[model samples]
Target chain A: MTVTRSKAASIRAARRDRWAQRLVQCGLHAGLMAWGALAVYPLVWVLLTSLKYTRELYADPFGLPKHWKWSNYQEAWVYAKMGTYFLNSVLLTVGSLILVLFLASTAAFALARFEFRLKGLVWGYILFGFLIPHSILLVPLAIFTRQIGLYNRLGGLALVYAAVGIPWNVFFLRAFMETIPKELEEAAIMDGAGMWSVFWRVILPLSQPALATMATFHILSAWSEYILALVLTGTTVSRTLPVGISLLEGHFTSNEPGVAAGMAITIVPVVLAFAFLQRYVIKGITAGALKG
Target chain B: MRRGRKRGTSWYGSPVGIFLFVFPAVGVYTALMLYPSLLSLYYSVLEWEGGPISAAPFVGLANFRQMLSDPIVPLALLNNGRRLFLDWAFMLPVALTLAFVLSRLRRGASVYRFLFYIPVILPATTMALLWRFILSGNDYGVLNSLLRMVGRGEWVRPWLSGDGYVQWSTSFPASWQHVGFYMVIFLAALVGIPEEYYEAASIDGASGWQQLLHVTLPNIRGVYVSCMILTLQGALGAFIYPLLMTKGGPMHLSETLISYSLYLLWQKKTWGYGSAVATLSFLLGIIAVALVWRFGRQRESALYR
Candidate 1:
């Protein structure tokens, strides 16, 4: 009878432990879900609010719009001239990506393959660019751009963007290039390929993944940059989406829904890009951070 | 001998090839980034408006002296310090907790990770604008509406309009945006831990919390230090959220060093003073980086020993 009683006690204890574990699991799920909700709530609110008429927004800030006014986006795009700004931003991002990839890859290739005097010095010099804040350079860069007649031009802005991206690009790409075996290049060399052709054909093809990652990073950063764009470009012709949207906010201060629509327009492309390339973006960021 | 000579003449060893490959990047980077940085140092000592560089008169150490005496400098530095403190206090533990929880999950972890990281991908301007609306000072604000719904209406105050709450209000969005970033970092570190460590701990009759303490945290000490350094750098150079939300307003209460420098240059048009402020900010960033490096190295050594 005592043995049977002890067996029953052990069963009860096991059941209690199971219950406790379930409770903890539930609590963990709830906490994580709550955090996820907080992360997404503001974005959803803005998106929905952008769809509401002014009266509906004031009536219920948190509610779904009674009538989904997609025209808000139309107005923001056409009437606010965000369309033009959007084009400029695309141009700058693409232009800068091209320039950065071409220059940084070539430079990284040379740095990775060659042994020359001043190699460490040059590497250190370029790496120092990582530490200098953009704010500190804002004044002189503005002056330099103006002096060089590149101020208020999209091409010039793209050049600045490329310059800004090079240090990190070179740093990351050099590391990537070093991992490519010398035998691959040597085989190409045996086939009578010059250094340029080897890099262009052999090395560049091999570094596609790293190049894509860096390109995405450049696109995201250049697209979202504000202060530099603000300082450098003074007019609508050259102004990027972020600066234009900021101006929209100022111009239509009381028109909350209109401004929110503009914000939504600015964010959608980024969101779409992120959705498709989430893995690459996350990998690039982690690799960069860890390497640094 | 002929093959060796041919190999030597190839592009990899050729000086012209090196020049062609490397000079463009080096030249542009120097002309744009490095040169301007040095020019900023030079400009900090000169009494120049936004005019011809040659026209400006050099006032050696005057801008620095003026900056030392400027009352706004202290306030801005203090605000940045407060932001760094708040971010470390709030973001680190919350992110760690979320990361830990996600790491423990068996399935759908990627979905949770994606959801959590949504905020990180959104542009800072959009985030600031959205947050501005949510924290709008009036009755129509989201927070106020929620408070009223929960019968806590009395607790609601003008979040961004008043001096008392403006700093916290401006800092919140930055911390919110970056929690996912640091969460991912910590998650990566957590995922990197070998499975055997946990198995050993469990075999020793260690509870989940005990395993975390003994196995997880110690293994991730290096990553923790990196996260801390990144957080510090981010806090020091924070510009966008404050620029959009407060514009360093409520009588300069929310001003950070970056925004303050921008204000001095853009609004006030005090080039030398602004450059001086920028130089000082740069100095602070260097100092912070050095301190973090030393602290991390010391802790790492202590742990190894």
Candidate 2:
């Protein structure tokens, strides 16, 4: 009778344990769901606000609009002068990306596979860029640019972006590249592959994830940059999206509903781009973090 | 291996020689980044309003002298300090907790991480503008509308328009925008902790909290330090939020050193004084980084063995 009672007690204990696990799991899901809502709600709200007419915007900031104003994006694109801004941002992003990728990849390759004197000093020099805030460097960067003919030119701004990007790019890419097996390069060398060929054929292909990671970060920084672009761009021709959108603030006079609409318009291309490349972006982040 | 040795015959013939072949990059780095930083230091010693065709007179520490005497300098420093503390208070624990919860899920973790990180891809101007609308004083604004529905009508006010609330009000949006980036960083670090450590602790009959303390916290020390440095630099460089949201204020209450300096440079054209401000910011940043590095290294070495 005692043995039968013990077996029954064990069964009851196991059931209780199962109940506790289920409760914990449920609580975790509930918490994550609340956080997820908090995260996505702001983005969704802005999208809905963008679709509202001005009357609806003023009358009800939180309510859904009776009619969708898809034309708001059209207005922002043309009348708000975002097309010019978009082109300028694209040029900047492309220019900076090309410059950074070339310089960073070259530097990273050399640093990873080569041994040299003053290597520690070289590494320290690169990391030193992180010590000062860009704000501190801006005054000097401006002066230096003015001294050169490139101060207000697109070429000069790209150079500045590339300079700032090189250190971190080299650091991150070097970390990843170091993990690549040395045997592959040795095998390539045995087949009479020159250093340039090896770098192009072997190293480049393997470093795609790292390169993608750098490209994502550089694009974001270049696209949304304000202070440097603001100070440097002297005309509508060179003004990027951030500065262009900022001018809308003056046009609206704190008619925040319009400003919200404008921002939502500005974000559409970037969001779409990210959405399409979502897989690569996740791969970029996870891989980037590991090396970093 | 034979190729490596053969290529080393000439000083500039090896793969390593390609490393020093970066003289062009080095030149650009020096001319663009290093020289400007040094020149700013020189300008900090001068006394002149920016003029297109005139020389700046040497002022020999006058800028430093003036910097010490200025009351606004201390205010900016304290403002940055408050932001760093507040960001740590809100972002660090919140990110850790969220990441912990997310890690346990069987599905949707990647999707959730992506959604949370979406705001980061938005322009800072967008974030600044979006929060401005949400936090606006009128009942039509989202927060106030929600407050009204809850019958807390007294809680709504012109958050950015008054001196009493300007500082705290501006910081909220700034913190909101940055929390995601750091959250990702912390999540990455948390995910790096080996599952074996937890399993070992469980076998030893450790509770959940005990495992967290004994296993999780120790592994993420490097990330914590790096996060602290990044957060500190970001707080000190605080410009976009104040610039877009408050234009440095209802009464310059939201002005940081960078904002004040940029106003001098871009608007007022007080170039010499602005460089002084820039120099002060640089010195403070270096010192802050050094302190954090020292503290972090000491903690790390002590924690090992």
Q: Considering the two chains of model 1, state its CAPRI-style docking category.
A: medium
Question: Which parts of model 1 are misplaced by more than 4 Å?
Answer: A1-23, A289-292, B1-9
lDDT (Cα, 0-100) at A78 in candidate 2: 76
lDDT string for model 1 (B83-131, tens) is: 7887789998888889899998867788888889888878888888777
After the best TM-score superposition of candidate 2, give how far the Cα of residue A238 lies from its true spot, in angstroms. Answer: 1.5
- Candidate 2 clashing pairs? none
Model 2 lDDT at residue A270: 78
Per-residue lDDT of model 2, residues A1-292, tens digit only = 9999999999999999999888988887777777777877777888888788877877777788789877777767777777788888889889989988888887788778887777777777876776656776776777667777777778888888888887788888888899999999888777666666567788889999888878877887788888888776777788888888888866667455566667776687677777766666666655545543
